[model samples]
Target: MKKLLILVLMLAAAFLIYRFAFKKKRAPREKPVPVAVSEQSAGFNQSMNSILSSYYRMTEGFVNWDTAAVGSAATGLETALKQLNVEELKKDTTIYQTALYPLELAKTNTATIAAGRDWTERRHALNDLSDNIRTLLLTIKYDQAPVYWQECPMAFGEGESGDWLSSKAEIINPYLGNKDPKYGKSMLNCGENKMTIDFTKRDSARLK
Candidate 1:
């Protein structure tokens, strides 16, 4: 009876050890929650749209070689850019930091363009401004409208290149501008469409 009792005690200890130590433990499964678009995001989108509108006008001014129009459009673009909520963006640290550089660059260049400088200087500034805006748009994935990235190969000279954004696929070369004093067409159809930003598709994927 004593031996049988000892055997039963050992078996119980082994079972307990197996159950506690050698058992396959289950990990807690994580469920993905959908991110609902907030009012703040919508507001941000509206602000970006306003900026884009001004930018489009500026680009058109350049295409027409209207210095007064370009300067006015640049001022408007600068104002719209200033109205953007940097604090709101800072809530997402990574994105905020990533976007800061381009935002600043665009703002600065817009101001420079608005200063009523010579065409060469303004064109250079516009080039930088366009590039920075492109970077910002791609990084933030602004959902207002589809932006077409267009590049002009002979923008600055024969070999140099520049890029600009447009709401439509059609290319109106802001770099070439008017050929003659009468605002005649120059290299108006100069560039090609490189990319298009459509955030709706990305948002749809996230919904799934």
Candidate 2:
């Protein structure tokens, strides 16, 4: 009976060691990462995004020197500009009135691009459009992402230069264009970053 009792105790100990100490462990479940989104800014951001999308397409057209593509994209950009959430600008009385001017100017520039007589005319209009768009963004306190303001020293001529806005800092000279038979791709990357416009909420400290 004593031997049997000791045998039973040893078996129970072995079972406990296998179940509690040496048992295969199950892998832990992973937690999902939370996505941050602001509903208040969604509409304004979307509207601005649409405008930039069309604007970038227009820039691409200019870079390729495709007149038809530029005209089409210019029309698209004008339409996008019209759909801007101007009401958002009304939140700040100071900028509310100031914002409309640049918006109108941008639209006008787009229209000019659409009806431009030649590549030179359209390119000039695009440069004006870029300036107006940048002003509008500054007036509206754009907070989505940084916009790179770039300048090409000899874009128009040896003594004339032009500025443009881009999402990336990398220079892609729309005025020079890759389609230039002589320069080919030599002048495509000719430009310097003038400034970076970033008004994200995290950068609110800058306003102070």
Candidate 3:
């Protein structure tokens, strides 16, 4: 009985040592590093900023229900779109193809907006134009300005939503606009901010 007790105590001591001391130490888990936004030429950055500015102007026209102003802003957007140094984007084949897809669509939609006179159709075209421009910015990772993506649930018809970009977080919805026959400006602030697009990197091309 004495021998058995001694052996049991020895075994318990060994088990305790193995449990606490023999286990391997684990390495601390590394936190993921955020990928930075890509850099572009000063000209590219300027052109993108100009395009965004023109888009904002167009949004204002929509909000104010000024057809002529909207048309003019659309034209200005086309000019700014042309100023973008597309060749600089061509160096990266993957990015070139992706960026051009939306850029081309922007061209088409802007042209439609500039030429169309139908109010409802023009508003719809602006929705398409807004999407294409947003896609282009995202594809190129444009990080110059603060772009706010907003959506109005009843901009078109009940249950149908429309989206537009703005320079501010405050939702002065371009759709439903400022002129409602029944309730003036009642629905002007009728949208919720979806997200703010700001991928600006720490690099130097940010002179906007």
Clashing pairs in 3: none
lDDT (tens digit, per residue) of candidate 1 on 2-56: 9999999999999999999999989887655665453248778888889999999
Model 2 bad stretches (over 4 Å): 1-40, 203-208
User: Comparing 2 and 3 by TM-score, which wins?
Assistant: 2
| Full-model lDDT for every candidate | 0.85, 0.86, 0.86
For model 1, the stretches where C-alpha displacement exceeds 4 angstroms are 1-40, 180-184, 202-208
In Å, residue 109's CA in model 2 sits off its true spot by 0.3
Number of clashing pairs, model 2? 0
TM-score of 2: 0.77
Candidate 2 lDDT, 16-104, residue by residue in tens: 99999999889987655544333237888889989988999999999998988998998899889999978776767788799889999
Residue 160 accuracy (lDDT) in model 3: 87
Distance (Å) between predicted and true CA of 83, model 3?
2.4
